[model samples]
Target: MCGLRKVTLREPYPDSRPKMRGTVTGGADAPVRACDVRFGSADRPQFRLKTIQESALAGAFGQTVLKQGIEIRDGQGRPMDGSSSPTVAALRAKCADGPAVFIAEDRDPNSKHTFVRQIFASYVEAEAERLDCEPLHFRMATRM
Candidate 1:
């Protein structure tokens, strides 16, 4: 194997919090829409649940119309914002110049409901094309 422990199963972090996106700007002819994808389960389940939920959501919302990508970066394409999460920090350290989509899937232990919040960067279209997912319905959920 690649010595990589897949995050297939994870204990819900008690303090799991919602994430926010940074500033972004897209080129001409692009529609910026905020796509809020949320989900969660009551019982402790497998990681595939996330994938399943994502797939179903993509189906309902139409993947082609909802696919979105985001790249977390500092001003001037630098990595590591003062408010970046550990996931973001590690990503930057690994690939400084790489673009990253910061996805937050939050599961509430008591309610068993998960909230999937997606933050799309202004460059989501290009990135989504690279990933072959789909162009996202862009929106500003968090005010930067």
Candidate 2:
């Protein structure tokens, strides 16, 4: 378990003097001192999603629907085609109403699979279904 240690200043330093102007609110015996304290991280440290993954997630989804150029008359009274590219329909079909899926493919810098990929699908039936509104099987490559 992680815990913090109490710090106290025993006496005033040669250059620094205690300003004992007012009495202690709790009582006289209570120690009132200031000292520098440091804290470290606990065990089982969790990591954050890299910046590339985050950017790719938002950018990829945004670019998919925007490609069809077909206006969605639902929200904002304007076009709702905010998908980043054609792959948006396939992604939405696979995940259904489920959370977005982020797959990390480890590859060399020169290899093709060395990037973060995100796909959304709606798995309501037996297998993941691709939304049929448009054919969005395109991919948007994100730069490292």
Candidate 3:
């Protein structure tokens, strides 16, 4: 089982202090006060896609067509594309009719999976049923 505990410490050093209000694993942790350190996975050599047996690039992470051949556009009437992450309110305000695909995209440059692309492409392919029209990714894969 896992639980979170509140930890408050008083230190006479800085004007601002940080409390260790995080998950407890019953392990020793460095006493941090007003420390601005963010933990993240180390930059690993871009993993191999071959391991997953998938390689489909979005020649451009922009734009999808509706069933009626209408291109998905942002509130500005611009064709939705690029690494843009729009909010639900934005979509609701723009797409008044229907079929407002959220288009979840993970712009993580290190991850080795094209899961986002797969979802977007598969959805577009299934809904639009237009193979030739499915948009492509803008970036190129690593050189062989």
Runs in model 2 deviating more than 4 A are: 1-94, 109-136, 142-144
Poorest stretch of ten by lDDT in candidate 1: 86-95
Tens-place lDDT digits, model 1, residues 1-144: 001122121234324331322222342222221222223432432111111112323334322222333333443454331122211111111112222232333333433322222222332333344334433334322322
RMSD in Å for all candidates: 14.4, 22.7, 19.6
lDDT of 1 at 95: 16
Q: Which candidate should be chosen as best, given TM-score against the real structure?
A: 3
Candidate 2 local lDDT, 51-72, one digit each (tens): 1112224345544333443222
* Regions of candidate 1 where Cα sits further than 4 Å from its true position: 1-5, 12-79, 82-97, 107-144
Ranking by TM-score: 3, 1, 2
Superposed Cα deviation of residue 50, candidate 1 (Å): 10
- 46-112 in candidate 3: lDDT tens per residue? 2111000011222221234112222344345455432322110011111212222323223346443
| Residue 5, candidate 3: alpha-carbon lDDT | 19
> Candidate 3: which stretches are off by over 4 Å?
1-78, 81-99, 105-110, 127-144
Model 1 TM-score (2 dp): 0.20
